[model samples]
Target: MTHITVDLPETVFSALRKTPDEFAQEMRVAAAIKWYELGQISQSKAAEIAGLSRAEFINALFRYQVSPCQYTEAELARELSDAD
Candidate 1:
């Protein structure tokens, strides 16, 4: 796996009241949420990226106000039609 380093102002930690590890974890969760919401990645992939279990990721989505569903209106209609 490839690792990337990010440089932050020293005051950022103090300002955010987060330790380096805590901040890094938050960044991972935020990235996962954004990618998942944008439909760039599947929920399982996002969960992996966020270092969370699938259930945990679903909870995170609720906390972050991101819907778990990614279906479009037409897709929903088709699904409903198929169900009937």
Candidate 2:
């Protein structure tokens, strides 16, 4: 894995000191979920970015109330047709 450094405000770092790793992990998960919600990335890519396996990421999405499914209009139409 490539290592990158992020500079956080002293106050933010101080607050994160109690559980820095957990804080960072939560932030990554939130960012990944937000990106996926905005259709900016696929579920697998978002999961990778969140440092979670696909199933774990999907579960996280449910825990966070973020839907993991993407449904386009055409896809919805196809589903409706298949139901007929």
Determine which window of 10 residues in candidate 2 has minimal summed lDDT. 12-21
What lDDT tens digits, residue by residue, belong to model 1 across residues 1-84?
Answer: 768899998898889999999999989999999999999999999999999999999999999999999998999999999999
Q: Estimate each model's TM-score.
A: 0.91, 0.74
Query: Each candidate: how many clashes?
Result: 0, 0
| Alpha-carbon shift of residue 61 in model 1 (angstroms) | 0.6
- lDDT, residue 47, model 2: 95
Give each model's whole-structure lDDT: 0.95, 0.88
Tell me, by lDDT, which candidate is best. Answer: 1
How well does candidate 2 match the true structure, expressed as C-alpha RMSD? 2.5
Candidate 2 lDDT, tens digit per residue, 1-84?
Answer: 887677766677576673666777888999999999899999999999999999999999999898788777899899999999
